[model samples]
Target: MTQPGFLFTGTPLELTDGEAYHLRKYWKKGRQAHSIQSLAAFDVDVDLDALRTLVQLDCANCHLAHVASCCEGGFPFPPAAELLPVLDEHLDGIAALLPLDVIRHLLRKGLYERHLETAGHRTIGTFDGNCNFCIVEKNGPACMAHRYALQSDLNPMSVKPLSCLLYPLDLIYSEEDGRTLLTALTERTAAFSRWGPDYRLDYLCANVELRENLASADSPNIRENLPPDVFAPDSYRPAYVEGRQLLTELYGAPFYDELHTLIQGGRRP
Candidate 1:
């Protein structure tokens, strides 16, 4: 018999709470520190819709959106587990789909010239139903590196760069931004590739191709169709600022005073 097409050779990935904390810290420092106007000047779009989606997506998946948020990245924030069974019912409708080997190959590619050569050996790894750095223990069926379907928390669906966040949708520092905000150069290029320069239908075509793949493969994982998830915001300071804002708004400056005490004491919360 012919070899089964689309063999899932990938090792399953998991997430953990500690990893989630670190990831969030990295993102805030990496993505949100820079000005949006500069990003737009650099062909980054900075469109509100895409930006919202990016934040929503990233935070939901990685728990970088906010403290006390869910630790997972996927769409629909809280996708119903019941969809899995429904998806199973349509598996037969998706048989002729081609294997997304190209997509997988891209996932393994390094953004920086020496990325894979160096960082390739290191991985966040998996844990009990999450990445070793995951904050949310239980999650719907999806991959943290690719899908943002069921992710909860402060979503940064568009924060892409380095080898950790999704590119294209997840923009990060270009040499121009130096040490500040991350932009969506990759995501914008992808969008332009699909819907720009006389290829207005490329986005639609990609969507169709993805749907066909989903039907053919019996899997609903997003990484199977898109690039890997790799994002690095300017720093975690943005997340901290946002968190501080939330605390201040909800509680008051006194809350921040207590937070200072806890931070001085080396407490995470």
Candidate 2:
């Protein structure tokens, strides 16, 4: 019997852009409630308290009922050296509770690069502080706060709220039926079945999630105007072919070759 052929559908996205969108959205919306509950009207730890104050001050006018659409798919706000003193003042409390150093490093790099293109600063990289996804190098040494927490024997990852831990993973799409779906094709079987063999892996690799997050947020128009950055060309790609290619890349010639033999000899699903 002939095996079932799968077709690819959906759009592709830039991985960097996806990461930026996730981070900004989480920072802007995901933590809003927490900020109100934990930080608002409090002045305990300098750093945490300051962060709470910042959130409260900024969100005093959060008129938007649904937060999902508010995120503009933008990069993180670059870390400001001006905020260093505030961070330093609350370092003890911050370091005690969370990965202060890591947070600082990421924020600083973001600031240096000016992700949002702040007023009077439209440059992309004046100091070339962008990370090429090398977590250890960019996310480590610069983060003494994170290192400090590790030395104290705390589960930093657990202490981190869902927003921080679920950075790139927050990518999801929502359907009219209201089901949330993950887009990362981390497995071969999944890639073949959900995304189609001919689907554009490049876009998939970048856009971890889809319209779901955008739909749930304040910027509902994003789903309609998500630009052809990743999804346009992907709609026509076949799943079986793309799946076969992905499988070959992951398992190598010997494994894929053997798998192909087995698949060809088996009945269609």
Residue ranges of candidate 1 with Cα displaced over 4 Å: 1-36, 39-44, 52-123, 126-130, 133-171, 176-181, 184-219, 222-269
- What TM-score do all the candidates reach, one by one? 0.24, 0.23
Find the number of clashing residue pairs for candidate 2: 31
- Candidate 2 on 1-269: residue-level lDDT in tens? 63222111121221234333442343334235432121211111111221111101011111121122111123222223333343344356443433445446545754224333333332222222322111223123223333444565754332222222221221232222232222222222122222222221212222224322344433322334344532333442222233443335433666445533432343222
Clashes of each: 63, 31
lDDT for each residue of candidate 1 in 1-269, tens digit (9 for 90 to 100): 53211100111111233433433454444346422333122222233323322221243333221222222331111112332343233222221121244234324641112113122333333333333223343332223322331232322222211123222222222232232232232233333221121211121111223323433533223323332231223221222233444335434686555544433333333
